[model samples]
Target chain A: MTVAIIHTGCANIFSVETALDRLGVPHILAEQPAEASGADRLILPGVGAARPAMEKLQSAGWDAALVAETRPLLGICLGMQLLFETSEEGGVECLGLLPGHVMAMAAFDGGRLPHMGWNRLHFEIADDPMLAGIDEGDHVYFVHGYAVPVTNHTVASSAHDMRFSAMVRRGSVMGCQFHPERSGKTGARILNNFLEFGA
Target chain B: MLAKRIIPCLDVRDGRVVKGVRFRNHEDVGDIVALAARYAGEGADELVFYDISASPDSRTVEPEWVKRVARAIDIPFCVAGGIRSTDDARTRLFAGADKISVNSPALADPDLINRLADEFGRQCIVVGIDSREIGGEWRVHSNTGDPGKTRTETRATLEWIEEAIERGAGEIVLNCMDQDGVREGYDIKQLTAARAVCRVPLIASGGAGAMAHFEEVFRQADVDGALAASVFHKQVIGIGELKAWLAQQSIEVRP
Candidate 1:
């Protein structure tokens, strides 16, 4: 299957490409609207503020292109936040793929902001296909300040300052607030699950 | 809940991992790729690779070595030292570094932190502050241990940390010169002072000798992570066993 990782000028593209390469998954990074349209599956990888990232994507027409793509798609980190309706980060509107708003994590008991580091995944659906082979309480790497609330669209949740969506899915489109590309063996397994996922 | 991190810091020079006492008397450990893979397998939460040669020689980061390690280990790892510009950070990130740390260069140009945070995201920038107590004031020192180079300005340490955060530093690596490699324990005074003003994740580095030292720092300071070198390198403490001990002690760590 042809895979295209949509590059919106955010970092972590090479990390994702490297992860896919190590998993022996052939993939190409597509930055242009024309280039992004040729893949069978797509991934929106991100690592920056919502305002600037949205500005660049909207300017290049990727925001509309991505929403229009009916193929299986995955978003990571800021890319995941961009799938929501709006974000308190930079007070920006997002792609509206999912039905929630991304807001700042409420004051943590004593934890740090950005909620950075490894945390266990609490699955809403224990047998989620995207999390196949990923055991309960398995640790995944996370790094972000804004997060969507746990709603029906959330397939998994993780608690840092408060309970937030760790993984969300609606039909064929899914997103992970954690970086599966950088989460080691469990990360590689999750990527494989996404690769093998039949939409 | 976010688990407390156990980071193994690898000081690399000429592609080999080295351990230094007080930033001097360096001794080679092993291949960085091999050690990084071992640490990841042993349940190390993250890895910090400092290019010791970068600042001294005034050269850029070694992307080839970074790519080698990135390919070998799947866990998140950060590359630090001698990064001065957004292009420098971009080179490392494109080469697969999860985060890029800036030390002396940031001291020279504080705006680089904002530029890096804007381009690569705040999560990708770590401001490393090597500090020590002088004249009863916690002063921010450079990573270099030269006494003449140390700055004891009244508000230098806390001010730099606050400015870094405002300018967009996602994390802080508070390495205390007075306690580094001494094995007495972490610099609680320094850590607590920095933690008081630090809004981002604070990583306590240096002076880790045994399991209890780790416990002391985690318990005493509200740090998000603890970084060590000699203890892990000399087999004084294994990552797996130490993590187990931390868990047993009620300190949360990834298994």
Candidate 2:
């Protein structure tokens, strides 16, 4: 099966491509919506802020195409934040595929900003296909200053200054605030699971 | 809870990983890609590669090794040592590096940090400071701590750290030259002092002799991460063993 990785022109997508290569999964860098729509699965890999990323996707016609996509699609980091209704970062409206708003993480005493490093995932939906082989309290890498609050769509939750959605799912649309491509073996398993969708 | 990170630093010269005592007397370790993959298998949280010979002439790391390491290992790695501009940072990042660390260049031009943060988000810009205690005060050193040529800057360690953060450095790697490669322990006194002023994630480098050193830094200093070179390169300490010991000490670490 072919997997299409949408190029959002945000940050490096080479790591994600290399992860797919290691998994022996055939993938393509889909700069256009048609290439993405024609693939069996889609991955929206991004980094940087929300507004410019959204503008790139919108200009590339991915916003409308992704909104209408029925196939399994996953968003990573800023890509995940863009799947929501809006973001506190850049104060930009997003794809609205999921029903929530991304807000800046609250600052508490002694808590560092950006919430960088590895954190445990506390699963809310243990049996979801995306988390099939994953266990509770599995550690994943995260680097961000803003995150979405825990909502009904949250499949797993983690905390820095406050608890936030670590992984979210709504039908075929899924998002991971952490970079699975950079999270080591556990992350590799998650990507492999994404490749398994609709197989 | 965010687990404290354990990072293995690889100092590369002529494309071979090397380790030295106090940033001198360099010795070859192994090939870069093999060691990287081995460390990832051993459960290292992340890796940092510093091209020791890339400065003064070559202003950027070779993209070939960065690409090979990215293709070999699945974990996140940071590339440091000779990144001078946004184009250089972009080259490393596009070649698959998760982060770019600036040292001497950032000290020379603090605005380089601001520019890198502006181009690629701050989260990917790391400021690596080589510090040494001179006249009872910690001072920043330039040129990778080469005693013959390394110049001690007038910028105090704490002041530079605060300035770097204000300039949008997402992380700070405090490499204490006095304690580096000595293997006694991490410079807890300096680390604790830096942690107080550092709002960003602080990584302690230079003096990691045993697993307890890692514990001591995480517990007493409360730093976000601890980095070492010789211990892991010489196999004096195993990553799995160190992590298991840290987890038992009630310090959160990736298992």
lDDT per residue as tens, model 1, B100-157: 9998888878899999988877888999988877787777766373333444444478
Query: Over the full model, what C-alpha lDDT does candidate 2 score relative to the true structure?
Result: 0.91
Tens digits of per-residue lDDT, candidate 2, B1-255, equal 899999999998889999888788999999999999999999999999999877644557899999999999988899998899999999899999999999999989999999999888989999999998999999998887355668889999999999999999999999999898999999999999999999899999998989999999999999999999999999999999999999999999999
**Candidate number achieving the greatest DockQ relative to the actual structure:** 2
User: Distance (Å) between predicted and true CA of B170, model 2?
Assistant: 0.5
Locate the minimum summed-lDDT window of 10 residues in model 2 chain A.
A105-114
What's the i-RMS for candidate 1 in angstroms? Answer: 1.1
Quick one: RMSD of model 2? 1.2
Instruction: Chain B TM-score per candidate, please.
Output: 0.95, 0.98
| Model 1 chain B worst lDDT run, 10 consecutive residues | B145-154
On a 0 to 100 scale, what is the lDDT of residue A5 in model 1?
Answer: 87
**What is the lDDT for B142 in model 1?**
61
